[model samples]
Target chain A: MTAWQTKLTETFGDACKFETFRDNIRCDVRTERFLEVMKNLRAQGFDLLLDVTGIDYLHYPKAADRYGVVYSLVNTESGERAYIKVRLNDPDPAVPSVYSIWKGCDWMERETYDMFGIVFEGHPDLRRILMPEEFTSFPLRKDYPLRGRGERHNFPTVLRSDG
Target chain B: MPLAPAAQYPIDADETPDHEYLYTLNFGPQHPATHTTLRLILTLDGETIVKAVPDIGYLHSGFEKLGEDLDYNQYVTIVDRMNYISPICNEIAWHHSVEKLMGLELTPRCKYIRTIIAELARISDHLLCVGAAALDLGGITAFLYAFNMREKIYNIFERMAGQRFHPSYTRVGGLMFDVDDGWVSLIRTFIKDEFPKAHTDVARLLNRNKIFIDRTKGVGVLTKEEAINRSASGPVARASGVVRDVRKEEPYLAYKDLDFQVICGTGGDCASRYLVRMGEMNESAKIISQAVENIPSGPINIDVEDKLTVPDKSSTYRSIEGLIQHFELFMWNRRWKPPVNECYGATEAPNGELGFYLVSDGDGKAYRAKTRPPSFIHFSLFPHLIEGHAIGDVPAVLGSLNIIAAELDR
Candidate 1:
């Protein structure tokens, strides 16, 4: 294990599971314990949260995890990055929001929720961001049809009175 | 958090508050200064903005969803629309991520060529940002001066990639073609002769102008702490004195070898952001000149044996082997399949940190392709920065950030 991975594992104990890939460190944490780990990571100078995105593993037949939320964080001083990921099963894919830890994750969590239908428990404005508020479906899921479910045609046309 | 009148905030409730009411103002989904369809719902106490809430998603196109459907090679066309101002930067960034996923190292010549093109794209993107920002602040002369130079860069793009706007010129392993001698000379001329003169003209028109300075200075200040907290990047963060340039820190492509400076600003105002971008343009021109002079001569693409790169036209037309290689590359089933693990590859896009997070399920198509667009993060900082400022300063702030709507929505 690299020094950072060792530090993370030492800090978080069994909750931190490190996966190193191509000079990048990806630390997968237990869903319930991720918020605690994230707070500590924030205190440890992992200042900037780069992105928050969700991945559905329905198409990956061999994979055990059904849904995953990936948080890419960066140490602004060193430019070193790490990914904190949490896996969830079917029915309820929920994770604690990291908005309080890194304020940047507010919209990112909203975007993740908008696209993946992932319930962020403590997010202040937990609503659809990129998609319309009325839009029901999460278009980013692997099971979602590429051409869409004809939602574009469902809206009623509002023509101008003189037109 | 219910919408209320101004009287609620006053403790005494008798400080002449009954006559004053907070009214709502919508800046866009159609405002001219907002270069794209971005809606900002501002709670205004007369002219000064009390609070601001950005209502995005007006331009969401589901590009990430589209990326999952398209193959690694086929998705370059879709990525081009993310930042329309610097389409080649998007191409290079996408391909850079794709190549990282595939674990391919492009040739030395390919690196130099990409560095030159990417820097050109940066200059052009900054040119548009500076032009539009100045134009928004009623400086039409500077806008024309900047764009006149931008047209020459577009001409170079047209010559090199065959498209001025959405040049999907970058492939997974390398570029679509090599830069010819004439194209190189054109780029050299653009860097050496044209850019400095136009840059000076624009700078002279806006930099020290009293009206420009009065409107920009000490307005929409995003402090260094706030800049970091909001995860703002590129000139927005740099203007606030955040030393985070991906080209300087990460050094992808030929940037490590090339000589350039990551221009930063301490003022953190609209004027500072404008100055940072202007400084970056000069630095980009410097990098372009250095790269053009020292670009190594080698195969532009990875070797044909890799099967990830398209064969040259001469080879494809003259030899059956080259034809088969070309067919195999683009064929649906025969396209390259990467490992199942995921990797997040980022490039220092003109705006900021543009990253591509790709998850491959051991298939030709990516399982999940998430783009960390700089505009999205930068736009998130809008509400915080624009608060307590005059409504008219909205354009100045937004223009400085240079948020492309497509990128924000994507």
Candidate 2:
């Protein structure tokens, strides 16, 4: 095991479920320590924030959290990558912003906010990035209706080019 | 730091100042540079952009929400639509994520086929980028030349997969169907004949054109550190001399076996980025040529049990085992349930690093599926790059980013 893995195993032992897949160590950090783990990972040389996004898990039988915010980090020099997951309850899905550490997380975190309504506390400018501001509700949430209630009737008129 | 000329526009002393607060200029939901239905609400100070807050869900089709409703196998089609310009990348990324979770290894032949098709997709995507950049730079003829070539690549996709844009040709363990006979010969001919001519035309039309160079050179320069810090990948990062390629860094499919140079540019400007992509397209052509000639002869799919392999022709005509396995593979294949873990898999998408982070609950369906769309990140740097440049250069810079709204919104 590498130093980062050892440190990760020591810091969040048992609380952090560690597994290896495709040569990348995946650490499922406890929701509360998600930010701390990410901070530590960055200090330990995982400087690149490759991706930050969410997943909906409403259908799973024993799903502890209704949503998951997946953070993928990589050390550019060492080529060591880690996937750190933070699960959130459906009612109040939120996590601390990693944007402070990774500037790339700005848009990605906003995207998560846009799709799944997972708020990143302290995100520089958190807003709907891929949807109309007037639109109500997060579209990527599992319960969110794919086709709005009788909204098909509103399509022809509402869908006019915004020009 | 040279102040922009646009910043020099003087406020007239005689003109009556409106008492109204600074107005927010909604740039899109239909702006030409937005590429799709992206909307950016920019609070402006006269002509200077003050604060740019992007509002994006116009192109959202409830993909993640839809993922839950659809079966595992059926979801690949939806994934293909996420990045419409290079649907194959999306398809393969989704497939690899699920495959990783399931701990399934595809046959060598399947990997080679995937590599070939993926390179074709890259070529088509780069052609679109170069062509669109030229069009944005006011060279309509270059756009036509590039689009004509793109059409040929699309035709190849159509002939092979029977779909033009969103071909859900990739499956979890292998391809949805094997390549038809003589497809290799057709691809070989395309690589030898059509591909070079198109590239030559693109180069001749815009590569070093004075106006194009003046507009693109030294514009939107991202430093190597900034590119890495911003998690930029593919051509955008490569253009900045950051030698990070998912294929080269962490090999997948036949990338480990096949040989190709990792193209890089030290300039980190729009021109450098353009050249990098052009070079990459040529490299992709070479990879495809190599793949076609040396493709191994074997079953395209792994020798998995019937349940995980292929579906039966008709339920009424098939035996009970076939029906059971079909249901297992299609509807409820617990055997293919991924381990209770998470995996991040990225590919060299046309825009950048198209990665998929999957969380598996050791169940038939994915616990969570998160996509790391390159365009979304690349577009984040847009305001930063376009801030000080001339307004005329916005479209050229935007085109060079090669953002497909589907991926951006997804």
Candidate 3:
């Protein structure tokens, strides 16, 4: 973790805010500089894009940002991992897609978009993944009710006679 | 590794095929070779798969939404259903994330027990995959031999956790129940006798079988670069010569003490995937045997002063303080005072890296609980792997990928 932190501090000093949590490096990158920083990090040897998850901090006590898109990257060589977090304002939060860096993030980005309604700008195939194609609600959002809003009830029942 | 079987099985030159019209085929959604519910919308040129669009989400059960409502301990039930093949792995992964978030250190005994069970889960998961692959490729004998061994593992689980399939067996700081010597003996018996005999049986059955080799050898070849680019892990990536295993790379539980080689395959084909899983099952058995033999004697959970795990049954029944603690734990809840922070904890599950990214707001339940299921990422690799293969080769490739449908759509 220290190995990457020093290089990160030297390269993107003030641009990327660095912090440590539970033996891994976490950097807060601004939304505009997200793509550039990621491309640079890819060059820095974080080859594997482990995960892309979205967080809706609607009523969170700590975070000031409304939505958060977390990109977990790993350097398979040194076994080093770091998280690149880009915070965005609500009402159509968008972050540049890392699909250009790692083609594997395609489904992850789509899933994030499907859940948090956080659009991944420049994603190749951005669509709902875990939810139905016609689903209108972002189910994972804090505002979305747990039991659902009669979405399941509205589904056309296919009875035995109808079949 | 051989490329697609276009040379082996070509479009018949006898028929005058229309160039403009391509046959649209629905491979699955409900098919035996799919082994689960997932639809691959394939654009075909004769018998070859031109392109595949996997239509998933048939098993979306609002799992993440339910995570928001349930507390940390109660959410284990939902996690079990994520990768339902080896349900204990899901439980371990969920608790691993929660424990990391809450900064809890498990006891030595607990760590050893978890390591054994985790390896058991890995073995069980691989058996089902390998057995199903054999079954899909028309080798029922291997499948039967594999399931017989898997049933023994289930017996161990039933003895230890009281459930066979969906074992909600892990808690935040510890396990559901501590194992007795009888359970340890059962695990030892499986590891020593049942595992080796079954492994040998399946190896003998499929390793040299001409049909199995011909069907899987060159089918669905994935290069090391493509595997890395697609974020493939576990046996899938290892079979492609990507020497990355979360257990060896990031030592957790009792893995650091256990000695086992991270298996790698040179072929990067369906056959290599099968071989990698076969080699890994042996490694998992070795790990279990070592851990079971060197079992530690101590308490299973963290210190009671931490107030994380449930009190022992004896204390709960006998003592007044224990009853109140139980009452506070379930009824009042909201006892957690963890730091308002977030962490991503990953485990090298049987499939791949099963991780949980938890955001704690100093509350009982997670502010955000995002699961990083391996199958979801692996499913995306389908289009690339099955691009040029024949329709008949779909089962061989799919079985190698071992896409647990629920995990992919969860």
Q: What is the C-alpha lDDT of each candidate?
A: 0.88, 0.79, 0.88
TM score of chain A per candidate: 0.91, 0.87, 0.92
Docking class of 2: medium
Q: What share of the true interface contacts does candidate 3 keep?
A: 0.75
* Collision count of model 3: 0
Estimate the overall C-alpha local distance difference test score of candidate 3. 0.88
In candidate 3, which residue pairs get closer than 3 Å at backbone N, Cα or C atoms, i.e. clash? none
Maximum-DockQ candidate: 3
**Candidate 1: stretches off by over 4 Å:** A155-162, B1-20
The sequence of per-residue lDDT tens digits that candidate 1 reaches over residues A1-163 is: 7556777788779988888777668998998789988888787788998899899988785889989999998899877888999999878889998888889988998988898899999899898888888888888887889889888788677889847
lDDT of 3 by residue, B329-382 (tens): 777454566778999999999999999999888888888888999888888898
Error of 3 at B249 (Å): 1.1
User: Compared with the true structure, what per-residue lDDT tens digits does model 2 show for residues B118-187?
Assistant: 9999988898888888887888888898889878878888887899877899877788777876788789
User: Which ten-residue region of model 1 chain B has the weakest summed lDDT?
Assistant: B11-20
Interface root-mean-square deviation, each candidate: 1.1, 2.2, 0.9
